[model samples]
Target chain A: MKKLSILVGVVVIVFGIALAMSFKSELCPYVTVSYVVSKGEVRNVQVNGTIVPNSTKILPNNTLMFNLSDGRTEMRVIYHGILSHYQEGIPAVVVGSYYNGIFHAREVLLKCPSKYKVAEENYSTSKVLSKG
Target chain B: MDIGYAFLVCSMLGILASIASSIAYLRGNDTRKIVKRANFAILTFTLLSFFTLLYYFLVRDFSVRYVFLYSDTHLPLVYTISAVWAGREGSLLLWLLYLSIFIVLSTRRLDKVTAFANAIMCIVAAFFNFLLLTSSNPFVRLSFHPPEGYGLNPLLRTPEMAIHPPAIFLGYAGMTVPFAFAIAATYYREEWVKRARNYLLVAWAFLGFGILLGAWWAYKTLGWGGYWGWDPVENSSLLPWLTASALLHGVIVEERKRGMKLLNYALAVVTFDLVILATFITRSGIISSVHAFARNKEAYAYMVLIALSLLLGFVVYIKRKDFFKCYHSYRLRERLIQGSVLIFALSTVTVLVGTLTPLLMHASVTRSFYRHIEIPLGTALVVLLGVCVVAYRESILRKSVLYSLAAGTLAGIVCFALTKLSLASLGVGIFVFSLAGVIQGYSSRKIDLRRAGAIAAHLGLILLFIGVMGSWMYESSYTNINMGVGQSVHAGDYTLKLNGFREVNGNAKFDVVAYVSVYRDGKLVGVLHPKLIIYNLMRSDRIVASVDIISLPLEDIYIAMGGVTPQGVASFEFYVVPLVSFVWIGSILIIAGGILAALQRREEKTRKGVVDAEGEG
Candidate 1:
């Protein structure tokens, strides 16, 4: 009985893993924003860049169009989701593919700018205090 | 500042003291005084270094690179304090400081294994101090002070952020106790397992609470209405916590029946190694993770060190394999309990494989992969819990099994009829049956704290399973909306209205607050104020979703703002999440169970101490 149970457990584990593999969704491979723009026909690739803030426009079918730039190259991205809490100049990672000069993003991930890098020193302490 | 010089000097002294204590222990001399003095010096020096960093942040000293990187002059006093560990270097220091304190506290027992444990802990502390002194030093001065400092992350400004990292670090540092005991068990004795068990429970509680807090923070702040993304960084933490949980259960079996000694020792080594792996993965840029801290060269060194540590642990296990030779077949209860632990261990392996697969391959595994493995394994674990609790009498076990089968079939039928989701229905049926069996077993006992804690914690799993099933399988989300002011939109049975908007400026941030009203069947439910706060200095905006929740006993109406237009057109997402509160309530019970178990152990220790003292007298 003990041996049988152990065998049963092994079989179940293998079956579960196989099932998971069958149901597994392919992850988008990481690529640069410039690379995505250069290729212009890549499918399901992850691109990271800074969001060009004022470029965000709400489109007709729950879709959003924005420009993402990596300091050197910029690409227009079409995302079909709620706008995440990110603004212009914040770095973000979008997973999708480029087609017809536009990247249709399946997912958008934003990195906490303050958490990941030092915030810029443009605004002075007095300006912040004045706002308060 | 001379403070850096002083901190380095004192840390150097701590290293000397630690080495001396280890040498004294190896020479078969009385290590009590050396261990005590070494632990004190290490704790004091680590505390001094921590405070020095805190002092820099408090004084807005941009001269210190870490200070300049994490804080600004306009930062609040409370946030300035939290800024101490907001960066990579400072967070490592925080881990080191916690480890120093853990060393001092855990060594106070002065058992026969003290020398060995102290030696192992000191070696661990030395490694951390070495990291602080060289590669990732927080005390490095900038070449020139900038005009203004960068502020802490706006998302991390929450109250939970201040406590979450420290709690998680304490748990990570606390696991060194069991690691040391594992080594000690290999060399000197196995009696230290009792002390090790207490520390394990405490560490498990801390880690569990930290994970819970992180989930809560993510749900509240991410504006993404869901929690537990199973991202690589999150998976890293869960990996070690799972192994440690398995170790917790395995240790009890070892203490009671001496069968799983080898397994428990291996778990300790694996748990500690996994913690290091977690740290390395999170800090190192090996994996592209949004949640990971910025990558640095120190990550490579960490990788090498972790590799060597794992190799060393493997060698030790190989050498001590003879000490834990199992001789006999286990009974049904013991087998069931051990099987459950093995199942948890298997789950950890599955998660680890999935996490590492992304690093090796071009693609990452989706959440569906983990869910596929966890659901059936989780169900099996829940069943094992019931079996272990009732396996004392064969007749009773058989009768209970039959009853559970009948009840489970009935519940499964009802569940399928209601939801038409077969897997979820099966899970619900098994959960209900297990819960009933556990409650019955508890009621029959005298209800000691240990039994009560174990039962409560186990039963909490049923609720958690139900909660996950209900929320994940049955929840509905509506994403797209453009609602103008005073406009009502229908979502399920509820009508949500965009009432109005207002502006508030305070604490160096400007908020655009949107008033959202909910109505059900022409009756007003509640109004939620979701604010968009944009900091003046940082220029980063955060969505402070008011989370207008209509809380029911078994379900919730969770609503939050997506974005708002300047012209009063707002986008809002509405969710009908069922039994989500049970997840939070179940986590509380799990933590309480751990604490109660620890308290029971303490009481037993006191009783034993008194008995030994009286007999000696």
Candidate 2:
């Protein structure tokens, strides 16, 4: 029984590791870029770029956009979700395939500067106005 | 006269007195003289350092560089005093002071012939003082003093910041007591492990509370909606905590059955090593963290020297096992001891590997040198732990194995349903392990409450894991709306109406408050007021979300919004978190159980009989 339990534990652990590796492979793919006349889906490639908000001229609608520094490559993301508290000058990670000259990001990660302000003050009020 | 110079000289003098007294006691026949003088010197040095730092902050002395960088006159008096520990140099000084004070208190409380313990503690105190006097003196002066000092970091000006660091330092400094006792146990050839177990429990409690407080501060203040990023600094604190936790359990085995004596000694040494390592990781710029202090080469050199010396002592002591072998003849119940040792070794390895992985990756070696290091070590650790919990209940291997499987399956099912199959299916695995924990707890008849605390803590980890998984996977969020004072928006089965926003100006910050009402299923549930703060000193801003929570037995409806917009539209995010409160509540129970275990006096009537039985076994 002891041996059986140990074997089960080991198998469960190996299963977990295999699942992670496969998930990573499927989610991350290498792709080569082409100056698309239209949209294209590329596989397994790393893309680096800076983030710019869409409609920066308006108040609160500063939806994040990735301005790829490599030539004129760019992606405007109308995120199907909420905008995190990320701003300009912060680093971001985006993973997805390109569609019709635009990068359709499936996962977006933003690393914001750690806030060191004391707890008493509320920073959310300014966030609403800024979000607009 | 420079206050910095005065304090530096006083600290040096106190170090000399402590060392001289400790050596005298160690070498001489009479220990009373050395012990009394050493304790008094430690107290004097602590008071002197405290007052000097206080004066620097209270007077807004910009001539002192530490003060100039971390404090200002406009800061509140409470925060001004806390500014003493708000920066690197001052915090190191605080660490030294706390170390000395703890040593002195421990000396006064001990009545036994503890010359060896006193000497070891004094040496540790001397090392900290030397570091302060030479490398990271808080009293250093600036060549050109500015008129006003830079204010404390806006985040650190909170009450939690003031309380948390001191509590953590106390916990860290408190480890020296057990370290000293262990040394004394080795020197005197006595079973001091039993007595020192209480100190270990205390240290564990303080460190546990300190970590929890830090997590709470991060959750509410950072506006990150989650706690615990598994950052290096957090992991560093956790390393000592993990070892100390294992040692706390190991000590129980030693006290009950006189097993794993050598393992106990190694744990004590490692616990102290972790303290030094944590300090080194935070103070040195080797790793980037939210709490990384300014790097100083002198401080780094001092820490390296101390670490090397402690490591050397450990090696020499372990090699000459002759000193620790006097009690080796007494054996513990083999199965219990083996199970406990396995838990300790597994936890220690997991923490050590987790802490060193990033460093190994960034080392100035070939990439392949560290390629195999990034495996999901935490997952393996949790599984091993699951096994241990199941095994702890049964004396026989067969019974334990059968019980573990049954419990694991039930836990897995519950976790799957709770997490709602978000992201990776890891929650199912974790849930199975946690279910085993509940079963293990129920099966133990002779419930060692300390063991109960350990079980509770494990259960808490499982709940926390589930909560994090559910929030990450199944949780949905969205933002972008323009609403007037009477405008409304629908989110996740709820409608939020922007009632209004008001501006509130405090002495330290300006707040823009948003008031919003929520209706669920056409019934008004509650109101939430989140704010955005503009700190006057740092000229920085942060978004503070107000959350109105309707906590059910199984899940929580957490509503938080940024604030009311200029057009009266309020922007908000709501989270339907499952089993979130269990994480916090379980942690409290764990701490309470630890305390209960610590206070339960050993059954004095059974002690001599157990000792005799150990001799026979």
Tell me the RMSD of model 1 versus the true structure.
5.9
> lDDT value for candidate 1?
0.73
DockQ of all candidates, in order? 0.21, 0.12
Per prediction, fnat is 0.29, 0.12
Misplaced by over 4 Å in model 2 are A1-62, A66-132, B59-63, B109-113, B142-149, B187-192, B283-286, B289-299, B302-306, B322-358, B362-485, B539-553, B559-571, B601-617
C-alpha lDDT score of every prediction, in listed order: 0.73, 0.59
Per-residue error for B307 in candidate 1, Å, reads: 2.3
| Fnat value of model 1 | 0.29
lDDT for residue B323 in candidate 2, whole number 0-100? 58
Candidate 1, residues A31-123: lDDT per residue as tens digits? 677777787699867666778979988778778789998777889988886763556666677777899999888877665432221111111
**What local lDDT score does residue B394 receive in model 1, on the 0 to 100 scale?**
53
Indicate which candidate wins on DockQ. 1
